[model samples]
Target: MHEITFSTVDKPKLLSQLTSLLAEIGLNIQEAHAFSTADGFSLDVFVVDGWREETEELKSVLERGILKYKEQYLSKRHVVSSVNEHYQVKIEPLSNCIAIPSDGTDVWEIDTTQLKTENKVGSGSFGDLYRGTYCSQEVAIKVLKPERVNAEMLREFSQEVYIMRKIRHKNVVQFIGACTRPPNLCIVTEFMSRGSVYDFLHKQRGVFKLPSLLKVGIDVSKGMNYLHQNNIIHRDLKTANLLMDENEVVKVADFGVARVQAQSGVMTAETGTYRWMAPEVIEHKPYDQKADVFSFGISLWELLTGELPYSYLTPLQAAVGVVQKGLRPTIPKNTHPRLAELLERCWQQDPTNRPDFSEILDILQHIKRK
Candidate 1:
């Protein structure tokens, strides 16, 4: 495998551009390594095959692309800085505040007074989620806990807020707005009355009819397909991240750890909870959107059986079993053969063998018709 490396400031869409450049050279990437320092400087590496007689030409193209990327980044920063001078948006000053891009993105800046926080609903690594009302509408407010407020965490929260603003899909949670005030940074989204799928399935001892299970599968696949099409990777895809509405329609939620696809068609660092994490991810190997598909397989199994995968084992045990022994959750004997087959494909040891979300959607649609 041929290896390539570079470093740049971490930003959205940077990976898409790098991967697009590699593909333009007709290289089939086999592995990727990416990491960032505390100051947002990213180091990326890629391993590839399928080299033709155009190696020299490929080098020239990559060198030119890197220069172009730096130029564009500088230009965009200059423009945003200039626009912020004239814009009257009330932004609270904080040492940990993320630089919100002001290039006409539709991220609504909600006044802090408009949101009314009620009871706490859940908690995440960085924030406490609450049931709240915004502009007379029920919403979920994720407030970054004061103790966790830091440059890195704030940057991640900002990234999630920015990404949520750009996505609009029935299968994806709707972003309402955000309160950028210091000591109370919050992200607000349309609340799903039914809460998360994990609670519906395991916590409440819920069972799903085959038809309903198929529908849930389709909904998640559709959302993921849209994300992939936009070159985004929902690094953490699990039942807990899937919310249900009053009608039980599933919508993808929680993006604090999600990221835009990197230049190597994969990211190097480990992410997502271990139970739903792919083997590649667990091992800190290179992984791309296919990693999400692996998580979906475990989620689909959970939907079908209403049981946690490897319930008897610790998360670390399950992760070890998956990575070291290629173990997968056992399918219920009564499960449909087709469904079992689909799950196997999704959790394939070789990520390249796993089908994309679009194909997964088609298969679910076919199952729904049966």
Candidate 2:
């Protein structure tokens, strides 16, 4: 009888291992113990194996199992295989970021080995967000549904690579790298452990604090200011798109909707979510950076109110209310008066009249200081 433990892996591996070993000599498992603990899991396996194979064959089979599982196991990266070999594997390259060092030796590529993948963090029309790693550093990986996403989206994936290769900003979600190989349309980015501002505002209210909110506002403003300065308009600015670092610093995300200055006039065949979009965008009028400004305004409202403005309303309903009923977001009764005033300026009917992101930055900074 040999007792095996799984600190991480759950089922099939252990059961498969037992079955495979038993099948080797036509033996049966008489006693078994599969116990779980916070630290790991344990299994006491007893077998009825009176007749056995040659010693060399048994060791060779065990060796194969060890090597295979070693690639899939982590947190124990340097796993021993067959008492003769040791190895570690990850899907991502071994570097702090995607860029290779100028002098060489820093360059690496993804190993074909299947990796340990976590459950989805967020799933959308685009794909599922997964928290994963390469080498040893943490990373956030987005896995797109190949068949579901059309060829147009594949172009957007290329655009992300182009954008990330040229741009850098403190408050923006940094793109680390991308996987373009077959069966994978993965985009990698720096891991944001704290999640998004939306979580802090509504979902995580029980754990929210004033200091965190102030920091988030400052970081958000900084990120927007960077985009505005670069003449980039993030048409899809929303809560789920905003990501946070371990320090609670906010970074504007989803530049897939961004419009470069020359391309700013291009229009989507349809439109973004009506609730967060400006009336002009909904009307399909010629628009500019102010479109993002409008979304930012709603995002701020979400921060103050601890709920998405008009989130309870359906898309058709929100549009009707905005166009006909003139539904405007109201300030949270308990919020600071100064913030209420800034939000009012942000949601103004005339995009031209709204403060530019440069001015917006100043306003948020002032509020943070107070």
Candidate 3:
């Protein structure tokens, strides 16, 4: 086994270096861990050979590379026996218990009980999303693990559901209801049988057509406008959080990490997916509703290109690139002029420079009307 250790005062810098190293060796990443430690930080990466028998030579190269990181802070790089960290929940399949409600709009208990506990469609950081039914209706259900759902998380979850129920917007994914039972702390939502926009755009290539893409963009902007008007900020606005039904109706889902933006500095918990975070968020600066707008801006770009912004970089790295490199998203060929303009406005460096959701919605409506 070969190990290389190092440390850095700047987390982002060290991360870039590690990524550079990984990219050089043509190594396929098996697993990786990069978390904050009390002292500084530690990152463990497991990799395998890209080509033929370069595994032994690569190990030797990594061993020699370890000395480069032993300066100010302690950084360690190593090859261990398949470095696998214990992810909090161990989830299994939730039997496909689907029931399409008579109303064809909502789901009920009789629908949930039929869930095959043995099957799981998808799992997120906070919960596992299952494909269950209401009658003839198949829906995706997000159930929080008993031990994992803390008071704070629950508060977030409840507030999100409440806010969702209050607002009836096209872009916003409508909330069903929570399973009140203990241990089965679950939220039944509109079954976006097709899954998240992230999966659709990146994973499900060839699925999106031009009109559908623009339609999704228009829907998302409307949802953002709704939230902003309601004085809410979706801290975790990303493709993964955006759900799409079979009809291709896109709804913004998962407001569990969202917050009501009253004052500028409304800090809740350090919650959210890092990929979509704005630059100011990375700097630990006080952000407002516009920060959510920033995420929407990124999402819009994703919609246009069908690519995740700065996907090649770590979350921290992406944040820094947005800040330092003035890294804006690239537009795809044949993108509409109005969309290109609107997307640019959304990603303005100064959050205030970005257009508000009201204006965004107006522009989208005008574009679609044309």
Candidate 4:
């Protein structure tokens, strides 16, 4: 086995990107370890087999792969500075970032002093999720990392708070309140003890038998229907964003990239995780609420198979195949016919050809009865 190591500035999805790079270079990783430095750099080491070549040749190939990876994933609309011979993407100064509108009301403003953080549960490039208490009630707090906070991050935070404050539904995570003030920005919601469906499936190796799968699908469909009725596009609809409470009722969570549908009823901006993104959105074409339906279809497949959408391909490669080759995950042969049909309708290339969430819910309910 050959050991490979990579060190770079820490960023969102960095580990996934690195793993993808190794896969592209024909490495079968046997073990991996990651560490983050106090100075915000990440060090990743991998033990792998599959390169039976000379050490110098392997080194050359890996260097080429790293260069290509940097160009494709790291240098998007940002200046690059070299550190220790590795390039780091630099965000434009805070002044260059657009200012967020201050038109929102402060009715849900929370007292930060009353907030008690217990432990960190998860983290992202710009924020960390914590399990905490508020007014003696268990809550989940998503706080922006102080060092990573910038104008662009703040704008997203403001947008999440703006949309979440108005939302209430049995299938949607309840918005408790938000600390919108600077340096302590956090959005609080009811704690989801059961965690995300993504973790349960991928991390815990949990399986959803047909009955349980349909129930989960119905719950997500109800939640998406509710959001659509409110003219809100979740934009990112995947297992990771679907959380479960103590009672095992799944609720939609995470609105950091969600937005109110524009008055014109179509949006052109491309934003979402590529693995589950709709083709129209991937191509940067104007899309409507039906885009969420496409993602929901992929999420449904994820639930059915307990696997990532494109396990063998990188996210960018999967996106390219989705838009150009009309690629989709294969449905298992034993899948219920009606449910399989519903999945096909949801994956239709034309947005208008897809079934709405209401129809999807009805179909899932029918399957549950059969």
Candidate 5:
């Protein structure tokens, strides 16, 4: 067993790059585990069929691959579609240098002095979230814990910030700016007064009528539709990641685990809370935007019933049941027939069978009209 561990900014091509490196070094992987840390680093461990003599060669090849894909790993250069607007992000090879956009874009480089953090709103595997004030506007600030801040972590944070800056949708959280400085790395976004859907359902014991549930469902579907249309996969879509404004309109938040789809449009990584995770992701199978649809189905189930999926089981148990037993949250008998059918379609075992959010949005809209 060769123990190789490295941290890099999350990217779609990362797994392929590593496997290619191993093959070039004449090493066959016996077993592999790859997952993303909530703090924005991809951690991969591989058990390979190899000997001691090839260890040095394997390291060399790995280094070369890292160098070749340095930008993809460290600098997430945004695709600037405008012909006249020329900007590209570049990273110094194997160094802890910050990425610089050749031609500056609208990504705000926030001065730490301008941010005034208030009370702590919540905490997660990534870090603590706080309600803050920036530029006289209320903002939700996600401050990555000190120990989690590293060179690769910064790169990932930069990627997410730049990506959010490019996205514009009412159902998506508004990105304000980020303080990229170490020991205080923070992401700022427009504060959602109603908090997350998870909190609304679980913490507040809120009960949603069918029409209200449909409205929330439609908001999420619209936001997810926009994300999918942009070729972005929200690898960790869940009720906890869905925020609600004071108007009760839902917006998609938490892009720490999100990634731009590669040319092949397939991602191989088990990322997301296990309870809401797609079976493909749970099985470490190649997945795409359809994974998000699976998660949406779970969220819809939660909305309709106001209960957690597999609440009696631990995360590991839920994952096992989902992968081995094809366990899905039960849709209440009273649910609208159309809505029930929609949920069933979203959580189909075959990814291709899952309806795209565009189709889901139409179904939801039709239900809302009644």
Candidate 6:
């Protein structure tokens, strides 16, 4: 294996771009590492094979490839003259907030005056989730931090609203409304009182009995099946995105990375968390709705064991293992034979071999009935 390292300015999708460039050069990456420096730079290293050329030749080829990539992809013009100039240029056009395309249906533009925010319930890189009240009804509000607001963030927020507004299911989190006006930009949804399954399992030291486990599996499968039926894929299907209500009902939440599949039924570009990511996705291969099935399998394993998948390895190591060595979380010997079989089928290396959510739901329901 030849080790290659790159250092450049850090930006969104930088890792994905580097990985794609490596793949384009016919490199089979066995290991990968990425680090962000305090000075706003990224250092990425990859150990790869499949290049049978001399080291000097490989270096020349990679240098040329990077130049071509920059010419073809990177912007030539400076995006902003300065921070102040950038803020001034961005704020006015976005002041009215994202304009989601309409299908002549009712829009849920929330009145900020009626929204009452209490304590923060959760936080993420770009936003804070609050336990709030909207017009006397309990709601969870996700507010974007104004300082972090940018074009890409607004696009994601708009896409999420576009998807959420059209979906309504008991097994899926319900969308309430959105305050699309800038600086106060936020999305509101029904409050899930019990928090996330990750917290329930890891924080509270909880374990699901067989019956409850099957119920959770069924709930998630049903939700996924609904999404798949509608041509939507929940690229990130992990315990963290699965939330519970006061009555212990599990519903799939978080659609920030979720997307409606293209007409061709395949997508590229890496999205979602690493540990739960499918092998094809980690490899940046063309993938479809089946990618979500693979993630659901890893998530089902989490529900069964109450342990993080590949807890023994760092996330990048886990990703490399999954793609290079076909690694999966070990199923306990005491696990139900049928469920164990289902897990294996779901983790099949070939996407076609994986069971669809509809089939998975049937299998889980059968296990419960038996």
For every model shown, what is its TM-score relative to the native structure? Answer: 0.75, 0.65, 0.67, 0.75, 0.75, 0.78
The parts of candidate 1 lying over 4 Å away from their true place are 1-93
- What is residue 341's positional error in candidate 4, in angstroms? 0.5
The parts of candidate 3 lying over 4 Å away from their true place are 1-85, 88-119, 134-138, 263-270
lDDT of each: 0.78, 0.61, 0.63, 0.81, 0.77, 0.83
Candidate 5 regions off by >4 Å? Answer: 1-97, 100-103
Which tens-of-lDDT digit does each residue in 1-370 have in candidate 4?
6666676766656656777877887878665544454345665656677887776677778777777777988664232221211122234344422234445654577888899999999987568899999999999999877665655467778789878887889999999988766666788999999999999999999999999999999999999999999999999899999999988999999999788888989875446787899988766467899999999999999999999999998676787688889999999999889988989999899999999999999999998988
**Model 5 TM-score relative to the real fold:** 0.75
Per-residue lDDT tens digits for candidate 6, residues 182-271, read 878899999999999999999999999899999999999988899899988888899999999999899999998788887888876446
Question: Relative to the unseen true structure, what is the C-alpha lDDT of residue 267 in candidate 2, on a scale of 0 to 100?
Answer: 41
Ranking according to lDDT, highest score first:
6, 4, 1, 5, 3, 2
Off by over 4 Å in 6: 1-95
lDDT of 2 at 169: 93
Measured by TM-score, how close is model 2 to the native structure? 0.65
Highest TM-score: which candidate? Answer: 6
Question: Per-residue CA lDDT of candidate 5, range 96-141, in tens?
Answer: 3345342475757687778899999998644799998998899999
Q: What is the C-alpha RMSD of each candidate to the true structure, in Å?
A: 14.0, 19.6, 8.4, 8.7, 11.1, 9.4
For candidate 1, the 10 contiguous residues with the lowest summed lDDT are 78-87
Candidate 4, superposed: residue stretches over 4 Å from native = 1-106
TM-score of 4: 0.75
In candidate 1, how many Å is residue 146 off? 0.7
The lDDT of model 6 is 0.83
Candidate 5 RMSD to the correct structure: 11.1
lDDT of 2 at 249: 73
